[model samples]
Target: MAHVVSKSEMRHVSVEELRQMASDCRESIWAQAQAIGREPKIYLHWTAGHYGQFWDDYHVQIDEDGEIYVYGELDEILSHTWRRNTGAIGVTLLCGYQANTSDLGPEPPTAAQIEGMARAIEALADGLWLTICKEFVATHGECADNETNDWCHEDYGPRTTCERWDLEYLQTDESPAFNPWAEDGSRGGDVLRGKANWYHNQRG
Candidate 1:
């Protein structure tokens, strides 16, 4: 079977390919989970804050260079978000979404990577029967939009500043960008939930 990836060049990757990448990064992810002492069930996607840097803090990880990784014990909620870690799953994209310069890095995520991201979300959403939730969306990352100053102190739910990717751009048929994830959470959350719902509806 061939992998027909979308024009995310549109950046990102295939979920199956991303899963294989996760297998490669398993050991480190296990080590991170051991140190954090958390368990999760909900899926949250993220990217490394720096370019060319991949970490096991999240269950699954992807790099700007288009490398994919999976951390062990992903089903167990880890400590990415304090209050939100109770029943959550976390995935990280290697490049920063809102951060340009040293954040997004010289190379941003590829179309395949983003496509994989959506697929991965759909897979998990179907697996867990997750409802529509903006657990991954956060305005902590760098953005020209001063829409909301600061994370509003968990009042919105989380204080993490790494949710820089605008996934909304990927949800539409419009051309996807290498640096397209959003911090609004709502924008990107729709894509995540939409895909998940579609998968669920299809299974029926």
Candidate 2:
């Protein structure tokens, strides 16, 4: 399980600084993923509440060898799945309140952050054979059949027609309202922006 940073801990850091940190973290995660030999896929939750709110935790990807594929803001991860974050890296951003709504008052991740995350997921997928829905069901139970619309419900099972958050959307660039950072300036904006270039350069 990846360690989630707290809001108090992130209070003083500048967006630029966080961005650099996110970059370094992503690099480390990618290297770890490569070493472990598993395709990396990250699961993100809007723990901080609604669009435009800032997040304080996130979940990351972990390779079979225990290598963590870290990406996105650290404060967005609400909690870990039953599988102990094993074979998957979990990251959490520190925003949002106990309520499901953003009324608690934290900014969500920015568009740039979301884009960066998308790129990272793409890279990890390209490098490894990823099974998003299978892993999600194995760990978090199937989405409810009709009880709750939450993707984490157990009844939903392996979705064949409907797209499960784990399997379909996270891997695609078309995810709805998916912003990777909280309002840009709240944390790590610059780093997320630079990740693609960094990744490209490193690949070369």
Candidate 3:
């Protein structure tokens, strides 16, 4: 059984290092996005458990402390949710938040991973020349006609738990300060805008 790692257990990776990794790995996505003119308007987060128990499920795979493995480009429209994938750059942490609920274990993201995600988010946003905000980080997209009319998009989209309880979304002072060994299953009461927005402010 894979154990959920503590922050201290996670490997450390710098923003520059992670950025370089993504640049080399997902170069195709950036290139294709440019060629196709599909201006990325949103950033979507996910834990996105894999297919066939392998790690080939994500464009980027991030370990607890920001150690990341990048593959492919952003052009591949396949990802955690459906409609949200249309105009968004999808980010998935390998922390495994969306795994079977009964199999839930220590799979939340580490502090450094959260920080790294912040940097990555800002990096992608800059590369895409996007305006970062919760509204655009994700907003309701129209659902399919065949889906339940009982479902209202205003409060819905698939992968609602993509970024569950990750503290990178909280304001620094209000957020639980980083503790390398902390394991708290939070519900992201207020989206930290998440790491994406956090790192953006650093430049502001």
Candidate 4:
């Protein structure tokens, strides 16, 4: 069973308050796992660049044998990672999907909650001098078409294109100058590409 905490339950909490709540929640989770004779292993600390949107709720996946694996963003209020503190803010939704159902029910997070999260993320990014597109690209590698070669062949199969700028393009003169309004705007592409090339050549 998926457990979702209500927005109202967290609406009143400030960032500082939320941080405290996260600490409590983590402690409780650890205690419960220990009580049930399960060992806890956290694979990743809050990393920046991975946006915790789309899925509004945190989740614990339990296998057929009842082995549980927890996955989701740990609220920055509770975590001390650079990503959590200076780049990303966690927003949890209050509903869970059934194990087999790809479509989780309509337990959409409130507008206010979404807006609050956006504001928080913006503030964090501003503090760190990071933009949303840069963050996305950094976390997810080269946004190439999954079905074809890097040449972007569409006739072969479905093309997987990223919505943001492709930083890799800026590495060579083969890529055109960036235009923010263009369909393929290479926003920070040149800067990143140049930096990467310089560093690589320096090592050489």
Candidate 4: clashing pairs of residues: 19-77, 56-93
Q: TM-score each candidate.
A: 0.50, 0.34, 0.53, 0.26
Runs of candidate 3 with Cα error greater than 4 angstroms are 1-39, 48-54, 97-104, 139-191
143: Cα error in model 1, Å: 17
Candidate 1 wrong stretches, greater than 4 Å:
1-43, 50-52, 64-68, 97-105, 132-153, 156-186, 195-204
**How well is each residue in 1-204 modelled by candidate 1, as lDDT tens digits?**
112122232233455554454454445444544455532234444453454454545655555544545554555445554444444566555554454322334445565555555566655544444443443322222221222232323332222343333332332333233232444433444555565556546667
Given candidate 3, what's the lDDT at residue 185?
Answer: 20
Give model 3 RMSD, 1 decimal: 9.2
- Cα RMSD of predicted structure 4: 15.8
The per-prediction tally of clashing pairs is 33, 51, 5, 2
- Note each model's CA RMSD in angstroms: 10.2, 11.8, 9.2, 15.8
State the C-alpha lDDT per candidate. 0.44, 0.34, 0.44, 0.29
Local accuracy of candidate 2 as per-residue lDDT tens digits, 1-204: 335443333343333344444454555555554555533334433233433233323444322221223345433323454322323444322223332221223343444445545354334333333322323222121221221223323443223322222211121123322232224322222232234345545556
Leading candidate by TM-score: 3
Angstrom error of the Cα, residue 12, model 1: value is 16
